[model samples]
Structures are given as structure tokens and as C-alpha cells.
Target: MAVEVKNSESQAKKRAFLTPKRILIVVGVVLALGVVGAIALNQLSKNPAFCGTCHIIKPYYESWKNSNLLANKHAAQGVECLDCHHKSYLEKAQEGINYITGNYSEPLEKLTFTREQCLECHEEDYEQAVAATEFEESNPHDSHMGEIECTQCHQMHDKSKVMCSQCHTFSWFEELDDSWEIES
Candidate 1:
């Protein structure tokens, strides 16, 4: 009788230990999977190809193909999509939330770069772009004083500005396909 009771107690101890071991194995597997998934996602986001994988971004990519910035070669060489778009921690958080919620159809304005966003690198030009035309120009000031945001003249999405012909009496865009052909 005594021997049977001791063996029963030993079996109960083993059962208790097995439960914790199973729990630990499950937790470890879950953590490992999470790490692997995070690494894969980080790599995908870095690829420009990954950005264009979505159908919604096709227009943006096509616009970039025709942009002056693409012809610039210098700016295109250094600046990636992230350079202007993901400048702030808050912006990163916003992006994460958008991904988490699977809301890919947000307004283009929200995702598009603003004049303020580009100022991170173009610090010198920020004042000239935002400042009144009087103080900004070196030539004898003759034009009307219009305080314009960088985006006013230049379309932030394409990094292109209006043609001189758009405001003037010339049809420069008839043959020359410049970045911005003046929005109609």
C-alpha cells in the first residue's frame, strides 16, 4: 500500500512539470515566429519594388517616371521614398497604424510629401520657398509679392513646378514635355 502511494505522488509531480514545459515550448515558438516575421517585414519595406507592389501606388510610380527629379539623377540617386515621407517618429507611428488597420486607401495628401517635410534636407531653400518674393529674389524685384509655400508653385507629389508659359504668353509645353505642364 505504501509503495503504491509513493508512486502515485511521483506521477503527479511529473504531470505538473510537463504542463509548465508544454507552456514554455509554446511561448518560445510564438516568440521566435514573431521575430522572423518582423525581420521579413522590415526587409520588404526597404525595397522600392515592394512599395510599387500595391496597385494604388502605380500612379505615383508612373508620375515619378516622368518627373524632373528622375531626370535630376543627383537627387534621385540620394533620395529614396523614405527620405521625405518618413521623417518623423510620429509619421512612422501613423504608417504602422495604417498598416495594422489595413486602411490603404487613405487620402493622398496625408501620405504625400509637404514643403515642411522636404525642409529636413533643403533647409536653405525652405526660407526662400516660404518667404515673401521680395526678400527671396536677387534680381531687381518686379513680380507681385505673393508669399507661397513650396508646394504652391511646385507640386509636392511630383517635385515639379508650373511652366513659365502657363503664366506668360508662350506655349513652351507644345513640344517640350517638362515635369509640370501647368495644371489645367
Candidate 2:
């Protein structure tokens, strides 16, 4: 009976060592980590630093710092870099392509903002601005630069909107048109 008991104990140990359950548990852990790693990699691309990695975006980073919209502490507090820039996975992918191809390069210019991009958060603001009867009549920016993109003037990170007077005094234009007079 003692010998029989010893043989049974050894058999039990061998079975436990090779069990399917143990193997499955180990595989599950590895697969879970792989899934998590993939997600992390995807998120990394959306980071503002990641966007700045491309030489094309470096200028945008600098200009955004000086913009009026970016300087607005209230907007900056609630809407972070990703909130305005990386709203969706599709946008992230598009950004990657844009960075590589240098497409839409001019929007990075100081005192500019992408109206479509800004409309995402300021939907009501955009609607009001667009629908206003003054949109055509008193739109100072439109008269000067044709139609301006909101993002072209507004920076996402710094949230600054460059005023016309920053570079060109109202008098400069007023010299050309009496209506360009400075307003108090």
C-alpha cells in the first residue's frame, strides 16, 4: 500500500506540471500584455510631443505658444492639447500623413486657426459667428485676408489669437482706407 501511494503521488505531480489550465493561464497573460502594449503605442502617437517630432510641426508648436486663444487659461484648463487636436483616431492618422507629406503647411503660420478644427469645440460660437449678419459686412479679417481659418490665427496649445494690430497697426491700413481707423 505504501508503494502504491508513492506511485500515485508522483503521477499527480507530473499531471499538474503539464496541465492545460496552467499553460492557458500563461498564454492569456502574455496576450493581455500584448493588447495593452498596442494600445499604449497608439496613444503615444497622439501626444503633442509626438506631433512635434516632425520638423513641419515644430513651427506650429512655437506659434501656438504665442497665440491669444492658447493664452486663455479657462479654455486651456478644460481643453488640453489632445482635446482640440486629437479628437479621434482618424484625426491622429491624418496628422501622421499630413506631417509626412507637408500638406496643409501654411496653416502653421502665426495668427491663424483652422475653422473646421475649432468648430468642434466652439460649435455654437462658430454657428453664431457664421450666421451673424455682420459676418460679411463687418468681418475685418475677411476684408483683409479674404476668408481666414480660425486655427490659422488661434493656437491649440497656447490658445492665442493674433490680433491684426500685433504686426500691422490700424493706421497702416487706415492709410490705405479711412475705415481702418483704430477703435477705442
Worst 10 residues of 2 by lDDT: 175-184
Per-structure clash totals for the candidates: 0, 22
TM for every model, in the order presented, reads 0.57, 0.41
lDDT of 2 by residue, 1-184 (tens): 9999999999999998979999899899999998897688687865656655777666554444444434334334554455554447566667667766777655464434466666666778665755552432344445467667765544444433335655544433343322122333
TM-score for predicted model 1 compared with the true structure: 0.57
- Range of the 10 consecutive residues with the lowest summed lDDT in candidate 1: 134-143
Which residue pairs collide in model 1, if any? none
- Judged by whole-model lDDT over C-alpha atoms, candidate 1 comes out at 0.55
The 0-to-1 C-alpha lDDT of every candidate, in the order given, reads 0.55, 0.56
Q: Name the regions of candidate 1 deviating beyond 4 angstroms.
A: 1-18, 65-75, 87-114, 124-143, 156-177
What lDDT score is found at residue 136 in candidate 1? 27
